[model samples]
Target: MADRAGSGTPISFRGIEKRFGGVSALSPVTLDIEPGEFLTLLGPSGSGKTTLLNIVAGLVEPSAGQLWFGEQEVTDLPARERGVGMVFQNYALMPHLSVFENIAFPLRVRKISRADIAVRVKEVLQLVGMLSLADRRPRQLSGGQQQRVSIARCLVYKPSIVLMDEPLGALDKKLRMQLQLEIKRLHEQLGFTALYVTHDQDEAMSMSDRICLMDGGRTVQISEPTELYFRPQSSFAAGFLGEANLFEATLVQQNGHAFLEGAGGLRLGPAPEGARPGSRRTALLRPENVRVLATDESAENEAIGQVSEVAFFGGDTRLTVTLPSGMSLVIRGSTGHGLVKSGRGETLRIGWCDSAVTALPEQSA
Candidate 1:
């Protein structure tokens, strides 16, 4: 059944814009979703991710721009005519219909033969590991199961693009993580282009082939998970993906080498390319880069502080160290093996490599 689904078709958005009369819901966004790629639209609420998704799904019309699905232009096409499947936050299933009938609804709508509908429904049910419960109704299934049935309903028709608007948002943490992998597996096995919308960075990081981060009703940054986390080019990109110690630093030059002087005289160098000397630069240092140093050990950037907060999370520990300049820095690591043995009120030495410090898109005062 998965093999018969065929490889995905790529879609491109050319200057897509949406406006609700006077208010702009989406700026001119031109993005390409690659074939068979799992791309996530990640941002806070009102970032236009949902609006953009609706445009792709033909639910909302863009005020401007063209939408291209492969070689065809679907901007003016009807929602029903566009080959798009949707899975929503709340499971939208027919409570009166069994799982088999729910999934078969789409195929039946296309006037497929009863024999074909049964075969397709059974095949998709087995693919999603719900074959045994084909007779279960929506009310009888758990949230996760109902969501799976929703997905099955979408897959029965073999739509070119799968649009999922926070399909796992209703589930618990453990179940959400489980279904994230499950969805990724299905995408790979079935080879369908996926356009997922979510505000959860962790979920997007774990599942997306590339994350399209949006903000202020515009596209912020689009990059792979690790790249987006480690070397984000924008301040919002750096802070939104994870915890970041961001500093508005003044650029300093020594021996023709560039350095960024941050709060509490914190110096980070050699600055990344495009950094202008004597200008205010934004610097980013993630908690994972910070090391709990011993008295005898030193790193490129060293700071001594009093432990202000200590949190134990299984094998890992998070510590907040308040430095002499009153700037608090957070460190995350596995301290159970002696990376850090200090507690609140105790003085601790923390440092990180010079190379670990990164510069984001420079911002003015």
Candidate 2:
């Protein structure tokens, strides 16, 4: 087994930028990936996540930037000389080659001794739990199995870093979840530094140690999963990560507390600290944080609305409530017996704690 902690140099990106003709594909961005850490680049399509990955993998050269692997400047290094492993979304295995040959191809290209290649191939196949299917060709394997072979092939050469570009996108949901866990476990065991690119929020949250969120070729935020979910620094981060009820408001007053006034004469409690009074801001509250309460009970922040729709998911019930001001909010509740019974046209009182709301700079509709 490879030494986990003392393995290799960390990856560093400085002043990275990529442009195609008149349009910029990636803006000036800089980041560092610690050794043995799993960092995910998460964003929607055309957000430059893949472009950044390609740049790091030597598939695409950055228009401007310095790339470093530990103390060595690798900005000018070719893909083969950089010693980076890459797993693609599609299983790019050779159709005629057996699973064993596919995993051994990298070693073969390097002209490694035949005996050494066989031993390394066996070790990686065992590591990925695909040893038994070594005789099978790519066409004979399932999608998940083919992905495993791809991963094993990448790891066979023991590259210091691994880049995965949406490798699980081709699998079904159930298989994807299973492979996600497997990949995470393998990373923990092998301790290889990894940079993964994906647009799926759940995949990024479930697997990444830190996520770099990008939009419009710019990095919006880089944070842990919990921080990104609970204390988003921007409205786009909040909305993109999960369901949020966003309301446009103006900070009206602040003394011991802050106050916001929204459309249709609605007043909500104080904004969280750092939010200035009289500034135009947007309030973000997650669906799970909002709750339906009885009419007589008071809450820190309450609103009157009518239940516009109800959906009963197996684990939780979702209710869409339209406020008197015509704004809609979503509330989540456990789907157990005695759960709040709400239906369309039913009047409902919605409330949330002051801490549950995050204020962001308002954006144009």
Task: Identify the candidate with maximal TM-score.
Answer: 1
Pairs of residues at least 3 apart in sequence or in different chains that clash in candidate 2: 258-270
Residue pairs of candidate 1 with colliding backbone atoms: none
- lDDT per residue, candidate 2, 147-262, as tens digits? 99999999999988999999999999999999999998988888889999999999999999899999999999999988898878888898899888878888876466567767
Regions of candidate 1 where Cα sits further than 4 Å from its true position: 1-6, 255-257, 339-341
- Candidate 1 C-alpha lDDT tens digits along 205-292: 9998899999978999889998999979888899899898877788888887788887777775557677677888788889988988
In terms of lDDT, model 1 sits at: 0.88
**Which runs in model 2 stand beyond 4 Å of their true positions?**
1-8, 254-256, 264-269, 295-298, 337-341, 361-365
Candidate that scores best on lDDT = 1
Q: On a 0 to 100 scale, what is the lDDT of residue 356 in model 2?
A: 80
Per-residue error (Å), model 1, residue 151? 1.0
**Worst ten-residue run, lDDT, model 1?**
1-10
Clashes of 1: 0
